[model samples]
Target: MSKEKALAIFTAVPRTHNCAQAVAAGFAREALVDTLHDCGGGRAPEGLCGALHAALLMAPEDRREELRKRFAAGAGSVYCRTLKQELKFPCAECVRLGAALAEEFADKPEIR
Candidate 1:
């Protein structure tokens, strides 16, 4: 999918539960969207607030793993890692949603 669309999906992830990690995962767009929907759209029966938060700030691709590893090594939970330790979340949701926005669009011609 295009970068804008990918970002739209990622940005929308936190509106639900707050797991930004999904946005940075190496998974497919559809899967990530579905996961976000489940968590944000009042469909996450189990719920994953922290994961949703981290995914929002994640890179548009698989690079989020690096953040995940960092989180794992630095903090015990994803929320604590990014919010308390890294202090990356500069938004009300505890994460800087779309921090990698430029990188996700880099190297690619503008869509449309």
Candidate 2:
């Protein structure tokens, strides 16, 4: 899926996609989307932000921590509650950034 289409899915009205769904859908990971259904709203394992969890799921195993670090550097935390309540970062924007950062893994593209 194209980047525009991915972002559109995340921003769709009536909001079907959760943070993980939105991020996974961005990279055409339809299967991941289903598995992540219950992972949003701070429910991800270890309290991970759903969007970051989905992005890490797509990267190489050895690179997951790196991706987490990179994501945290941008968002100030990898957990949903921190981002939502403490940092005041928005979920929609988290999905957008998570998908964009994950794209860098697939295409080796520089951060946009």
Candidate 3:
């Protein structure tokens, strides 16, 4: 899906999505959409930002660290608490960044 469409899903009315779901939606990963159902709102493992967490999970194992580091650099931190309470990074933007990175990997897995 288009990035704008993915972002739109985040606050898409009654069927609004969470950070993780928004990233998964960008990839059109239906199974991932289900897997991340409860992984949002700071509930992702280690309290990682839901969007970052989902993006990392979607990436190839070897690229996960790069994805995480890049995300941290851009978003100020990978943890949801830090992003939200400390860095004041909005969740919607987190979703956007995560989806962007995931799409980057999906589009070109050999770039690294």
Candidate 4:
């Protein structure tokens, strides 16, 4: 899917789905949505951002790491609370970044 579509999905969600879920579900190939849907919320199993967790689930290890590094560099941290509370990172910005990363992953078949 396109980055714009991913961003739309991320921002258009009606409820409080986490960034991880938004990114994962947004860029997921048709067959992967059901599995990736579970990756939403504030903090995932190990206190990771939902977007990061979802990326890990959807992408290969190397791709997931790349996404983590890129997200941390751009957003200052992968944690949702830190991004929203301490840094005051905008949700739209996060969604944009996540969508961009998801697009990168979506474009690479080896990464999926």
> Which candidate leads the pack in TM-score?
3
Model 4 over residues 41-110: C-alpha lDDT tens digits? 5546666566666666666666777878888998899887787788998866777777777667757766
> RMSD, model 2, all Cα superposed?
3.1
TM-score of 4: 0.71
Clashes of 4: 2
Q: How would you encode candidate 3's per-residue C-alpha lDDT over 10-109 as one tens digit per residue? A: 8688766788988888778888989899989899999999999889888999889989999999999999999999899998899888988888876776
Cα lDDT tens digits, model 1, 22-101, are 34332344445444543432223333234433343334354555544543443333444334435554332322333233
Off by over 4 Å in 3: none
TM-scores, all models, native as reference: 0.29, 0.90, 0.92, 0.71
Model 1, C-alpha of 33: deviation from truth (Å): 2.4
All candidates in order of lDDT, best leading: 3, 2, 4, 1
**Global Cα RMSD, each model:** 9.0, 3.1, 1.4, 3.6
Name the lDDT value of residue 3 in candidate 4.
Answer: 53
lDDT at position 9, candidate 4: 70
Cand. 4 Cα-lDDT? 0.67
- Those runs of model 2 whose alpha carbons end farther than 4 Å from true positions after fitting are 109-112
Clashing pairs in 3: none
The TM-score between candidate 3 and the true structure equals 0.92
Residue 22 of candidate 1: its Cα lDDT?
A: 36
Candidate number of the best lDDT: 3
